[model samples]
Target: MNINLKYFKEGLKDGVPIALGYLAVSFSLGIAASNAGLTALQGYLASFLCKASAGEAAGFTAIKEQVPYLEIIIVTFVANCRYLLMSFALSQRLNPKMNIIHRFLLGFYLTDEFFALSISQDGYVNPYKCYGAAIIGSPCWCIGTSLGIIAGNILPAKIVAALSVALYGMFLSVIIPKAKEDRYVFLSIIGAFFMSFILSFTGISSGIRVIIVTVLIASTFAVIKPRSTEDE
Candidate 1:
């Protein structure tokens, strides 16, 4: 396969910002993993495999709860369902003549940040750029997770607790921008928060409760405020 050195180098530069962000976010994730009794290596592997914040959150919740394997699978899928849509959008941006291997590899590398970078590029998207970004960004995520776990184990409890709050702050940063841009998204987020709060009083396990709240809130919004074709 021919490497586009220019695009690849540009990709590496683009990935730096993403790598830095992942280091902080995945550090909080590692603390959560440690709280869930995961070893540093286990947290590293999990972060390597499950790249999304929401997906990793759900997986760690399931593990902490000792939920059944099927429940874990279902929750993880539901949390990550948006990636399917992201993949569809990205597929349209790829060169149709691109090989299946590159297509598959790009799919694996399509985290939210990378997807935005890839989709915004002019002309046909080269898989090599995604590869370059992943090469730089992914290891930092994994290493950050490992470091978080180690820090959680060694650091003062109060310090770890404070650092863990960064994950929620990062989530708010992501959604607040979209919420400002789209009322429907804002409403959905509000509904999810309200529903999740109510569900907290129930005897339902956190895993099942999340699945219920997400499905209900999303389904309600999907029906009530269906996006126009242009929105897609």
Candidate 2:
């Protein structure tokens, strides 16, 4: 085999873990989608194209609740907006001499895992390695969603209902660990929970409620919390 091909294959081998991880997480997303009255095609397509599980989940929730289109747009934006920062950071790691198309594609596939791995590479990153990682992981995400949706349809309603809660559990799993480390974050999370609970009882719609609560809390924290000069 050619040296370049062999090196690319090595990158694919490294992506095995990332692909497996994507499979599990997106499987949960599929269940969420199924529960949300989304079609199987919708579930897999969203996972395949967006490649951002959190954003997709937020969007799915909005859809499930029958929130307005504008609110859906806002929720998805707020959820996935962090990717812009990740992309900016990843951009600095690439060789300036690399192709612009490669740079664009790299940025496109620069998920949290792929970016971390690419940035860890010594010196300027080879775009091919990132491609290798994306090629493996992206398909796994889509495939997992497809399988989950399919399984949800075939399973009993009780099983599907149980699986749907996995989305909330996933969010908690992501937040609780970090919240444990920081008092501010912990407080913010607790505050958000209370706010959400309060909103549930009021005449306020889910769409407006989410927008109001998220903007209010996040902006307030942005002003009061400490700011760091370096990026995460």
Candidate 3:
């Protein structure tokens, strides 16, 4: 609660670009939510509570299909499980003395963008910085989803389809730079892509396929190219 204004302001500034990207991506997600028969307010609440696009998309699909609640839960969990790893890494970077409340709050806000920014900090993360980013980015995503639901109803199908690509573009923007810097990252991406494509032909659900591909590729690389202790 006693966040430093200076760090908070810096986090707000750093969050602007992330907020913009989320706006576009979540708009497309709203369209998906609409397709799933979700009301604008429901879509808004979903985005507000759950920041993972892949997980949200899978959940929406499950809703549309009228899948059993257990299946829906499993799909969402598998799709969002990567965040558990991100959370673990971020926990290690936190000050050891930070309180449980702040830790839980940061864990709740631990999206890919926020985790990347926080983990890349020089030392232990200032909770206020993450708070500042969440303030600006999270609401924009929720609002964008609501607007997207409204737009999907009024806009032409072609326009909605075009807008949906924004989410894919946002993901590429995140990964491409890292891939260029690390060949292993690039290879992992390529491997995941091919595996995902092959799995698409199978009867497995999209969410389950994602977990299978991610675990296999990540485990393979961890063994094949274990990081040095210095890197760790």
Return the top candidate by TM-score.
3
Ordered by TM-score, highest first, the candidates read: 3, 1, 2
Question: What's the CA error at residue 196 for candidate 1, in Å?
Answer: 15
The lDDT for every candidate, in the order shown, is 0.79, 0.74, 0.82
For residues 174-212, write the lDDT of model 1, one tens digit per residue.
Answer: 578778988999999999999989999987656566668
Instruction: Give the per-residue lDDT digits (tens) of candidate 3, residues 1-232.
Output: 4557877887798787778778777888899999999999999999989988889998998999999989998988888887877787787788899999999889889887777666655567888887888899899889989988898656566765665564455467667877898899899999999999999999886767877888899999999888764542
lDDT of 3 at 28: 80
lDDT per residue as tens, model 2, 22-46 = 8777777888888788888888888
Count of backbone collisions within predicted model 2: 0
Candidate 2 lDDT for residue 22: 80
- Global CA lDDT computed for model 2: 0.74
Q: RMSD (Cα, Å) of candidate 2?
A: 7.2
Q: How well does candidate 3 score on lDDT at residue 215?
A: 83
Worst 10 residues of 2 by lDDT: 162-171
Ranked by lDDT, the better of candidates 1 and 3 is: 3
Q: Could you give me the TM-score of model 2 versus the true structure? A: 0.64
Q: What residue pairs clash in candidate 3, if any at all?
A: none
